[model samples]
Target: MTDEHPQVAALLARSHRLGADPRNTNYAGGNTSAKAAVPDPVTGDDVELMWVKGSGGDLGTLTTGGLAALRVDRLRALRARYPGVEREDEMVEAFDHCLHGRGWLPGGEGTAPSIDTAMHGLLDAAHVDHLHPDSGIALACAADGERLTAECFGDTVAWVPWRRPGFQLGLDIAAVKDANPRAIGCVLGGHGITAWGDTAEECERNSLHIIRTAEAFLAERGKAEPFGPVRPGYEPLHEDARRERAAALAPVLRGLASTDHPQVGHFTDTEPVLDFLARTEHPRLAALGTSCPDHFLRTKVRPLVLDLPPDTPYGETVARLRELHEAYRADYRAYYERHAGPGSPAMRGADPAVVLVPGVGMFSYGRAKQTARVAGEFYLNAVNVMRGAEAVSSYAPIEEPEKFRIEYWELEEAKLRRMPAPKPLATRVALVTGGGSGIGRAIAHRLAAEGACVVVADRDAESAATVAGELGGPDTAVPVTVDVTSEEQVDAALRESVLAFGGVDLVVNNAGISLSKPLLETTAEDWDRQHSIMARGSFLTSRAAARVLTAQGMGGDIVYIASKNGVVAGPDNIAYGAAKADQSHQVRLLAAELGAHGIRVNGINPDGVVRGSGIFAGGWGAQRAAVYGVEEEKLGEFYAGRTLLKREVLPEHVANAVFALTGGDLTHTTGAHLPVDAGVAAAFLR
Candidate 1:
């Protein structure tokens, strides 16, 4: 579709090139457009049309479907109907009326025009680019940005004083461009930059030139350590210690951020973040907040900066964090009260989206891992912008009242409302032991499919990674290798889950080994091995998870995959059966103990699950088959024949049971056993 329209193709190509570099634009931060002459389908006459990146679309991965097409004449005429600045939001609705050919696309649907549509459509040039590059924002954020613009690019790029994005801002930029005949672009005060040209190639070149020139200017004039020298005892901790501290603090920060709603988290200790946190001026700069709309929208008005140095005692650090969290929320609420107007949208969450710790790192939170990660990335961009601005001149963002207006704008609220409903397990984080294969693998996939970030823990590293990849890679699922029987390994796996996705909300204790032997043949070593893997392993995993979940103050689920053999005594299964029994009792015990903290524990009892069963294939099948007087291949059939339903239970059946126990539906029902067997009466609970 893009190929059929050369101008549109050029627009997309240019947008992609600019968007591909973080220095050019933040993710989904900016928009681009092209005006083309197209023959009207009905009139058979050339008519001017404008195609611009639609709302919520990222330029780098944009498609034809993501572009909103509007008639240029209709769009231009909007200038006459434009209400005063106070009612400028009405103009967003006006954009719909300007749709070209009813804005029909590949599937006869129209994309929503972004607020910046006017900025593109109102410009006189054939191609226009509006970007939020760090360098451009640095110049935009400087206290003397207008003067800096003149010094950086002379009269070629004009400077527009700060105006909240709306139809008015578009008119302001267009008027500035028209008044300055030689102006190729303008630095938007405390926002970003905009550039235009008659051709897409020229437009892209101008945008790059503006960004590079700003970068060069800042580099040449910037002072050493713009954030100021690192304070004593504020240097970043050692690598191992930094990560350890990050992991330790991630859950606490995530919990605080989730005071309004559950959120996943991302942690970063990069050089820039560390240097900034170590600086004496960071708290003051951070308090002023990010200048660009895109930056603040993700990072919030400001970050919660930990005042204590990195080497402070863990207990003391945690205590200070809690105190800071309370104060931050109170301050946020006051900020809202101070600026909120009658027509303003209701205040959303008061929790800080970004948390900065000296010597450790920054922790960013959102409803999902990707959102959290991108928020952290945006803050990193903010850091760079502040650095450059502070180096050449004082860093000055828009006033708090202006920021409040944008943050609580009705259009932004409408955008939030337009977002799709979250999945059932959208904010959940699950860790599945033995997640590499069989029952564990199925459970991992199920949880991930329902939108939970998953931690695939298995003894086999390759298998764990394979399953994690199948579940959609790092953002959705991460792989952790662990020997469940080892307490240190179990604790480490939980730590990995915490670091990867903030905290664990669901735990599946499914790692087990099977060995079948007659009473006379069963050895003490076999019994101890089975008990250590299944029974003690469950205890260790549960204990570790309980600490994290308790710290989060959020309820969680723990499901143990016990077996029907635990209740129904069978020949040559003493070791495996006893281990299963231990797991069953542990579920009840933990359920009783942890109920005060809202933690639920449950178990699944399954009959022989032969197909794709790692335990069955590892010699246990032949042993069980011999006891049943059947071939190994017929074991499933033989087991099913003895049951009321005469059905063979599969791994998916157990997976389904896990979901039922944890997937929000059975929230109040725990400390019980779900039977996935073919209705074996002997195994049924009394």
Candidate 2:
């Protein structure tokens, strides 16, 4: 926790507080800086430097390495070279060249500075804070924003018209600071707020004071009328019908957003989303640009609107929605062509991130679930800000030209380009039963590495949590305790997965017990114990998963981890073999039933995988070794030598085979059983 400089440490603490509060800044949205003196690497003279939050790092979880330092004089002097430049590339290049000692200042070595560093350096203060507070943005986006600023703070705060952040913005801010020596802050019309002071505490205080002032002004106006009730012709549908309608529409939207290569995820609206979309003016207001420029980076400039009715036939509704989506993309392309000037980069994807359906509500789409949720949150916030602005005065956002500049800015585009390529299962959700250890644990880890959000479910609650923590903590892995034998617990697990990650796309049924006993020696309890988890658990989990997968309308996979003994039973192991055989047969039957709904049900029969398996831990390995007339220590080698591959099967080997069954290559193949027993000739199916 030690920092290279005291000022950097102070700034880091303050930035964390601001970032943790969603009202102050959403994910990775704001920037903060501190001015200090550092020794010059070559000249040995003291040079003034500004340490600002670097790009692509969240302020709430920022570290010393997240801030980049640049020479103040070098950044300020670049203005002369770009006197009338409209493009931001030249200015951004100059800023990079000014980095202290051709690297970072101290702790920051490989990070790039924020694009707003130039403006932050030009301000006349030791500490500066910039935030997109909801209250301030409400006023900033209002028609009479400048007039309201004058009335709220009088001359204590300066007001600057909307301008894309670059060389010109830095110059304008400096002039305003010089004209009003006593001013503590400035409000950027149709953008955000900036506050500075000699100390970090003073700067934070000024920011809070400005936000409270704006809030008081809006409160004085009283509550605004709720958006007029849904248009008269559009009646609200019953709750059951609404859910059914959303289910029917999700697949169409998913298909429209997908490309030829096809990587897309989606989430339907919640209660609050439905309420907002039910408003009569929702179509017009939602089509307008974002409340501020930063939001465009998440939600795009505008959301697509559709007039889908609940009673429409499914096939016709899908056809009409597809046509509308094409039109929306065409409109987006025209907007880009209209604004592209010389040297503008080629346009990116034209698909809208947010979509509004009159009867079903809004849906947000992204390459992953986390990203879709982020876009959804921004849209919700935009609704609140628009409502507040309209309450005080007409909502007047910045012109479209400014939005284009921000959206296509090279710095912003670079952030996306830097991310690594996604894996095949990236953003998909999977639930693995008995994932605390053995084959189940290996499968969970593999799926996570392939970019899926995993839910580790086990009857042993502690073990489930331990495995989940190892994968990626709570953000990427969730832990749920469920004895899959119980129908209620199985249903609850499905609901939990949906709550955690919007929906489930994959389910691994791998929980069971092994019992080897002679027919005469086998008690009724032994038979029930084996069958309860193997046959009954598989059925319960499969039924619940099918319900959710059908509701999502997106294709899914269900894999059952059976045993080689099921194919060829061994002496005195009738109970275990019988249960596994039941599960294997059920896979084919379920596959036949659910195939029409796009659900693929398959099974994997793996034998002699005793290296890290729970079956071995339960003493089954010792018992089998005794039966084979070998010592416990020689069991692994004995099994390896028996297999065609002459190698002991590991959990990872089984996991790889499971991935092959589900990862697109076998999309058309269902009700098929794959053997993962190192080429067991006896277990091979004809």
Candidate 3:
């Protein structure tokens, strides 16, 4: 086995963290891939199924499961068929085909392999791997190409000029393999490196070696300065036009270039980085090409930066692009004919071209669904470089002529990259109420453990402070002391959280009040208080959070912690049950109002939360234990064991239920009550 095998998981995680960022979409995004032992259904022997990166997985929490697997031969055939498939959705089904019987994808139905799936599939040696190494690319994109290549790869690898992806890239790689025979891997100029070995461990070793070498090289050259601080003035355009144009061009770009990027047609709103790239001095990014040519394989040769300045004519714009297209097509046709042989069906048709428009930035064009993670890291390096480059002289990427040549060159491009699909909640944030202890605390910890910034709020200042301190160590957590039942305090706390951490993305109504009594013994005051805490508290919190979240244009999550007794119609706690029933219905009403705003509201009813501190001890006390006729210590087991799971319901378990709702993962589920009880049939689904 190759040395890279053992460290496969670790390397994948490292690569992910180093590359996670949404901003890098403009540049080459990073990719996560693994070559693991998968038993072939036909032979029942371990056939190598390379799992490539899935879309939307930020690097910090990438895992083998996040990578999509494609049968290699089938992947290569698809690349041969489509010349530029980078930004197209039609190509998605090809990736999905491989997952028909595979259960690893989210929803466990069928899913597409990542756009980078092609690159991983194309590696033919013992094992193949790739990533957008920021430091490595910095050296690779430097002025002296040969020197940088030598410094990083140390003559062990070959260098390929950039080219559009698909058949062209795969064809180029095949030719290279024929020539080098024993090449470990090669560096796609201006792109990341491809490292291979007999096993994942060996591949990781080589990858690390290459990365370290490149880092050392950059250190010697005095690291980079900042890049494109272009002030992207907003220019509005038709959203439908952008989407239609983006979808149309995705496939062509993919076929033209061998990038493992997904098809990002267009984004309604542009981030600062996207805006800047779209408006930089050189409006024609692809004609001049990416920081290097290899990016064309992913991002297409050029992007259609939307809505240019008024001075640029709409008619003149189309004319200019037509000319550019003619030139690019002529060159690509010539190259394809030269490399794939005369009349080979693979080289028959479709030459890729770039589109550019003013103002909108390049989003109007086909998108490179890359690992933003990789590009983000590279941008950081470029920031240091661009700053220095600015001080020295105007920063020039590759020459326009060289860029075009590289963008079309068959001998330079890497293999077709197929990308994995994105997950529903990759970068979502969550906040839970009453996190000082019990279910709230457990839920807060659970969310944080899953790679989210969990905000723990509670009425108890000390407990809230302690839980917040545990999650972020004073600075990360914002502990607020406020009673949810009090409108003024609740409003103030919500305002403080928004000011502190932008806005609350997820809110859990884990804090509630319950009072037990015979119907005759229940006072109007007692009923009012319990109703205020459970019903009023939920409505107040949900209403406040929804306003801010809707204004931000990004939806949010809300979960109310209710009780099974509310659904089961239990005796001795009419007020508590009625209050919960009110809370439950509130979820339905809030969900209806909030859905339009992209906000979700739901509830989880727990039968026996064994660890609650305040009321359960004072009110129900041994009465709850009496239901099961068990002693204090065994009381929890008795209540917890009543469920089908035959286990006690811990605060941690209840917290998990809150975590799920607040995650906004089950988009189909809202206005519903999910039970955390072992297996009680208490919920009356509506």
Candidate 4:
């Protein structure tokens, strides 16, 4: 719905425009506000109100309800109650209680106002915009940030030193504004920029204009000299070798960072990441805190740097990388304990959100693909800012204490704490063979909905891509065309999974073919086709996945989709049943062998999941109908009536069983069979 107030609408429009660009804002890092008069709820009098972007909401897609309205007088009056940084929690509580009207939208309520509501209230202008533009942050984070501000904007901009965002920082900004009444904006040292004017257009224009000026200044400096040379003992790997190394190392890094409930969603390598890692001073420079306080919520204070060369053997490097990851976590814990004061919230998991390998590139970690991509974007921007600062002057970010304050700030923590409980399979990766159709396709969709990044592997390339597109595209599901019987294709598919996501946590060995005939009539070709794709294919994929999962040291699940015919002998089903029976036995042996490595092997024996499946599309349904003396369309009814439950077993039913086995509930149980066959007495597992 369109906002009733034109000023509020205009401010929302401007916020979206600025936030739409990642260079301007990264993953809800910036906020905007507009001051206007609205009718008081109880008293029929006009009251001055400030509409600020609600905390934790993305500005790019913000709506009227996403902007919280607060009483300006009450927020300003809170200054007396919160005198210093010690009472920041109390100050934020007071800000929350000062909401205007019913405190939220009619249907949508409970969103907290931006933590900078007080700052926006203190400003005298009608409109305000605060953003973390890369160019501006570059200048603001330099050692001589204040002098650079003066040189760029002259008297039009005020400078505020680095301070954690709270009542005190707002007061400091107010003091700067009072001293320089003619200034249109302020450059926040080691933070960001804030622009204000009488209208939203003026505020946006001033913000962009200041950013442009800083860009021009940095461009001129860039022409003078290069920043530095490649660091000692670190040389860029050849292009092809680098990519191969990245694919090999991705699973190792992902496994090291993963917990029992892991969230290493994906790994990305780009030219910027490579260039940043190739610098001589990257080890020292990257250890400094983020360019702005807002980034602390996305990427931690710094990234973990690995000294191993790109040419290191994957087998030898896995154990060493795991050791480094452990050390990194230990250091993170020490850093937190040193800075954490009394009454502070308990520290969170110390796993690094970003990892840097000198000869390769950098990797960003998150629970999902979008978040990983967002963290990568922030690091890229940081690279640019650091380069610019080094060229002009020297990199000087916020102090460690300040970084800790922002990192554990209640406002920042609230963003994570307020989110709904994650799905059972959230942050886990699943590879489903034959996912283009049949039972495999249903399993892929089901796992993705429960929050796993799915790899849709099928022999039909177009079909696999189509299924992936339907399940939310590449960000959530990736398509891989693989004839699983071919060892090379199977190996490549596993590598692609590691490259697309970080590693594989679950493997669904659901790729199989149906070839049915009496023993006397069964042909050699039919026997080979069924056994090669079902038995041999499962072996290759399972072995590859087991190796990666063992190297990771994190437990994983392998689920095979067997058939009820394997348990109960069916007429004219020799080749299909024998191959499935072989797969079922393999599961038992695999579970016994790989259980030491924390890999669980299980199977699902499903009957008559013919609807919307490749079994039906490939004419297996018609063949089965002929055997039962029923028409093709009546086959579903025939199967449903024969079962004890009188319910047709569906692909979804099979998927649900897969979810139960791999979704952590069966952590201790393996070499087991889950039946989804509508209670077939003959097919029941003993």
* lDDT winner between candidates 2 and 3: 2
lDDT of 3 by residue, 1-686 (tens): 21233435554655554455322222335564655555566777765555566653544456655556566656656765563534333455566665524443333422246445555666665455565565555544555544556655665766766644334454465566557765666666555566667665676666667766665655565524233444354343455444333333322332232222222222222443334444354343233444643354433334433334523554554445556545666775665555453422344233332333434323222222122222323333343333323323333355545544444433222222333333433334455667787778887778766545556778899998888888765224568887888898877676555433334567888777666677898999989998888788888877776755664445667888888876887767788889988888888888888888777788888876756644566546566555445676677777766677788777878767776666546877778788878877555453
Q: Write the per-residue lDDT of candidate 2 for residues 608-632, one digit (tens) a residue.
A: 7778989887988887887788887
* Runs off by more than 4 Å, candidate 3: 1-139, 142-375, 388-430, 435-437, 441-507, 513-533, 548-557, 564-581, 595-600, 611-670, 673-686
Please list the residue runs of candidate 1 whose C-alpha ends up more than 4 Å from where it truly belongs after superposition. 1-3, 102-110
User: lDDT (CA) for every model shown?
Assistant: 0.92, 0.80, 0.56, 0.82
lDDT of 4 by residue, 595-660 (tens): 998889999999877787797768888888888899989898999999999999888899999999
Candidate 2, pairs of clashing residues: none
Per-residue lDDT of 258-280 in model 1, one digit per residue for the tens?
99999999888899999999998
Model 3 score (lDDT): 0.56
Give me the candidate number with maximum lDDT. 1
Local lDDT at 484 for model 4 = 92
> Sort by lDDT, best first: what order?
1, 4, 2, 3
TM for every model, in the order presented, reads 0.98, 0.86, 0.46, 0.95
Better candidate by lDDT, 3 or 4: 4
Separate clash counts for every candidate: 0, 0, 75, 1
Instruction: Compare candidates 1 and 3 on lDDT and give the better one.
Output: 1
Better of 1 and 4 by lDDT: 1
Question: Best by TM-score, which number?
Answer: 1
Model 4, runs deviating above 4 Å: 1-3, 102-110, 223-227, 231-235, 259-261
